[model samples]
Target chain A: MNAATLARTRGSLVGRPRGAGHVLETLAAWALALLWLLPLVYAFWTAFHPTEYSTHFSLSAPWTFDNIVHAWHAAPFARYFVNTVILVTMVLAAQLVLVTLAAYAFARYTFPGRDVAFALVLVQLMIMPDVLIVENYRTISALGLKDTILAIGLPYMASAFGIFLLRQTFKTVPRELDEAARVEGCTPLQTLWKVYVPLARPTYLAYALVSVSYHWNNFLWPLIVTNSVETRPVTVGLQVFSATDQGIDWAIITAATLLSVAPLLLAFLLFQRQFVQSFMRAGIR
Target chain B: MTRSREWLHAWLLLLPACVLLVLFTHFPAVANLWHSFYSTPKGARPARFIGLDNYRALVDDPIFWQALQNNALYALGTIPLSIALALLMAVWVNGRIRGKGFLRLAFFTPTVLPMIAVANIWLFFYTPEYGLIEQVTKGLGFASHNWLGSKSTALACLMVVAVWKEAGFFMIFYVAALQAMSPQLAEAAAIEGASRWYFFRRVTFPLLMPTTLFVLVNAIINAFRLVDHVVVMTRGGPDNATSLLLYYIYEIGFRFWDPAYAAALTMVLLVVLGAVAIAQFVFLERRTHYQ
Candidate 1:
């Protein structure tokens, strides 16, 4: 445990200083946390149990992967998973390259209208591409790129948030590094590649995690743009699968939900600290 | 070696991003306004300038009014509760509580899961009879509640889901802010025989105002951004009870093929977001900080 946590544990164990109120507060906290986690916990329970036991909650219920198998077979989940992975990777790749170059320019170069350009870029922070779906959809259609993975990723390729975060990180890089790289006969782009990019690894990592999780879970734009199984992301897939008029079947629905979110959920569980810290370090609200 | 080279290289580096940003964000924002003044073309007809017609229709549309009111209420319902709950979660997680790790995980798990996926599970939870809540209510000898199906309860049900999805995410910000706080202040307060509640109210809450303001802006934006759960859970059902502004826009733009109307709806949303952004900037500028 961290020293702070160790201190907390010691403080709680030495209960002479803290009174009944502390105990009550701890109980209340745990209760709220449990309430917060109830839905996901219930999903796990329902997913593992048989259809009959989904609602019954019997202690002796037989465990089965039948629901998962059924859920998988019931939808094109394999294709959806592949599509989502491709979509997230494409968006992240484009964002990384575009944001890095843009940030480098803003960080190092004194150019005409630079402040105005940066201000224009920052407009996307408030007016995200998702908000301009109608016009973007029109644009995508005009380009005959509708129902493609590229269309899904295109609008988000130039991410203002990514550029902003990278610019902030790049600005903190000492000027000496750039001068040193330049003295070593490296061009500006090479200096950025060799110096700025390496120094800004942590920011890139944080931004990548944020971007991947975001596009992976992004639904509305993708839902509007892509129609077929070839391009539908997991979120849209899961929505279509669960919103069927086949009536409510908790077991299968939960299994499908779990399947769709399993990769992200597993990653978060394994890298819980990194996931939380990256978000904090990114300063994203 | 010259200043012109620096400018040239900078423009070269910025060109690709600038192109895409203009194509997507900047261009679309302007296009949304421009299109709002035109009529959406039907087959064999062209989009023509129809100034104020779309806005006039919007003024006449009850669904527009309903969605606007619902979105406003949704914002009102989710923002404060989520922020308060987030602060509570952060304080608890930051405290000398047992199972801090588990509590932290529990609170944050929601933040990681996609809203679309979770809405399905919540769809079950709000299912009429065999749902979790229904099971509890039935066990207590009460009527089964069709939380998502009933018009009266649908928006509130969606608000609860939004709050659940948001609070944990907001808690991470609060946690970071809280962890950065000086423990020496708490020790000093204790030495002065200050009550915990008094110390929190007088010292901690004031210290957290900046974080609160930051989180508040985010909460407000999310109140509009996150309509995924509404899509999965209700689809703005029971006669548009759960229709937020974005969802309404989606319906008009995609489902109804009324881009002009959607563009007008989007203008309203953009204006709101712009106002919030400006307000946040002003707030940040004027914020007071106590070490």
Candidate 2:
């Protein structure tokens, strides 16, 4: 080989080491990923197969939907699913409207005590309704919303994180858009609805995904507030179903676990890219 | 006239959110502090102002102290490990890896699944004998360990679960941060004969400190906030070994029906979270960046 060709080949070897170490690292990564996924895989396995096969990995184990059928009959899963769907939808809807109005005020109009009001709003970021369960429970009951789906969604309806995120997104919208809408005879609310809201659609989407995921998975407050099957969300419902009093049937519990998580999991699988990108865009770690 | 009208409109817009915020977060926070000083009313007894009695009770309560210590240890253990593992995961996935999508999905799946539901599955993993963990250890000729049963291992078992659940979520953030980084930094480091380890240690880590702090804050809050797994898997059991602060507070507030003492416990949580919130604000305000 010529000197220049020799140098080029040598440089490639110097910079890029395709050695056993790289291979080992890749294997280690894959191993850990597999390990990370093992629990869910096991859940699916146990849920599909017989109870005897739950702890054992048997290739000969016959698959059946018996566990799922038993689990479904064992509890009001369909009702729980409905309650969860309604809870998340109610919470998300309320949050959108409230945060939109509040975010608009914060983003555009500067009224008296705006700074103080904003500071007060930010206080919710630290002391969430989840943390103040004792008193909030009292407040919910006082409002006579006890054991209701409304109570589960009420405290979180005004999300500080949602307001903060939307305001940030709103602040980035150009003055020209708002001004152009105003010049076109739109009211302030009209300008927000038509110009600002549309411009911040991506932010809205991000916040919605984050909100939905959070409330859907939220447990403690719902566990406290909702007592009856009529109002209990899936998280609470699953806990009640799988409690130790039922004697820990792994197959049935796994089936119910799969059932409870299936909607969100299915959505995540289908829209994995958006779910991840929304989280990144939403700036929530 | 228009200016006053504008002010009215702004207040009108802010009303609903502000009212809900006050009712849920602000009012309850203050009320929790206020009520902690009083005696919780029993059936026929009215609540009486017993100044510092509840705090005194909290101080004397061994379970409270145990919960506090366990929580401190839990936070300390889970935070650094998760954050470090997250950074490591991000680095691996961001590089020349095959099946990046599958790896990312695997890492992130737990975040999407509810902790309560997943804890039930992990509960099976930690089950004593003929359980997944036991089966593995037995196959390896080791003793069948009660991963979540024995007092010595229960908290650690919960910590492992928390770390597994959180590290992946944090990885997404780190991944985002790493991707946003200019690739030229790595090229320059490689040109300077910097080993990958050395480069990550000296260059990548320092640049990612802000994200690290953000993730750290989140991990801290979550350490306190998320006791759902504890509720499911352990119930602070085998003598409250796995009882976290929040779980204890829940027991005190709800199960035991001692809202006053629970309020006291909550004050402790609030104080810690408040400090964290302040730190976050200070850090964000500084907007620390690197060259």
Candidate 3:
């Protein structure tokens, strides 16, 4: 459903009375919400304030960008950012192309072994590449692609979730559209590009957001595969930076944490509705 | 197009994804099983087929047992609480609650943040003597306690982080399901003079079963899959109390340089997840008939 329908549904469900119990419920919700936001809020506070004021809350505490500056300079975070950007972009680009073609094949064509192939593909959903880290590392090192951003993104390039979501979306396209496109002398790939792709924009958007966020946040695999600053993504870099003997500088640690997540957090805050809706759309399927 | 041509076209389109999936997903899975029967090759020594020696060792490995038990406890502790909190958050946000936008934003914020980053933030929160929790406890006249260092509270502390990180992500699904619900049921219940709790218990809860099941499967998978916070906050500290299956595998495979043992450990994880997958398929089949 679209935004308007969700809004209408919410509006229709909002006819509760303003009694004492209702007030208490509201208070409880607010309390829980505040509690949920506390760690993040504290991180922001610690990151912006001086180290002395990390655990000391004061309304008039001085705020500065020095922690962020120090955090930026303390590690090769700029390189890490570049590496993360390359990694997520490579993964999303490859996944979109691969998922699109695979989805189109499954959605429109009859082929031998299609069901078996589909089942095999769905195996990734249950047993993800994350769990098979040991063997995948051997394969990656065998290929001599160690300590590269490509190694970080390679296993995840063929995403089962993307393929599944896009396949479902493609199946919803009318056969008439496919026929019309083919009748116009379009090839199978052309039919996919012209007919199906344009209609599944929302699904593409949802899948892209989910994919980007997942790759951007993925740590363990990247941690295992990549070795150098040039290859480490933001998550791994942040880990290495913090896990080093930095002597527990909470300000710089929190600042580095914030810096690593700033891009995604900013994106979420900017597109709050789209972010929530995209996650909902992605998860529902 | 002819049938052969159609098949060829589909194969051509499917070729890339299938190849990659085989190389990465399917191949590694089979290889994990194959390697588990062998021994890890040290320098100047080749791996020899050991025929379940790794499995035998795993049976005798206390760390393996602890990791398994910890994972079970982690899943049992976190799943129900997160699911419950998710339902509560969904109901509150879906209703015409005051500041609905703020509540929704607050709840869903953690979902978007990188778990590693949030785990680092939590690491700070759990630090002794001067951390936020300690500060609050001390301010309230309670003795200071090492939340993450002590064995008894370490896993529980990590579980709290897991719940905090995941409950919001799960809430969105419940919200989607709640919105899809027909308002007529609620209207009918109201006309029947049913209390809100009674109506929720009798009608809303049952209708949300599919969503609950769906979230339950996802939550279960996440419980097994996610060890980021564990790696960040605890590193299975205080005598392996927080070591998860995957984390243990990482230690064996990477830290200790033992691939064969890790493979055997991975087989256990794979088996657990395989069972979950089969259950999901069965539930999904039943759910289709339910609709």
Q: Report how closely model 2 matches the true complex, as a DockQ value.
A: 0.53
lDDT of each: 0.88, 0.89, 0.92
Put down candidate 3 lDDT per residue, B55-118, tens digits, no spaces: 9999999999999999999999999999999999999998877999999999999998888999
> Could you tell me every candidate's TM-score relative to the true structure?
0.96, 0.95, 0.98
Model 3: CA > 4 A from native: A1-18
Candidate 3's residue-wise lDDT over A126-244, tens digit each?
88998899999999999999999999999999989889999999999999989998899999988899999999999999998988999999999999999998899999999999998
Over all chains combined, what TM-score does candidate 1 have?
Answer: 0.96
Q: Could you say which candidate leads in lDDT?
A: 3
Task: Write down the TM-score for model 3.
Answer: 0.98
DockQ of 3: 0.68
For candidate 3, the docking band is medium
RMSD of 1: 2.5
What is residue B245's positional error in candidate 3, in angstroms? 0.6
| lDDT: worst 10-residue window of model 1 chain A | A8-17
lDDT of 3 at B184: 69
lDDT of 1 by residue, B73-135 (tens): 999999999999999899888877789999999999888889898888888899898889999
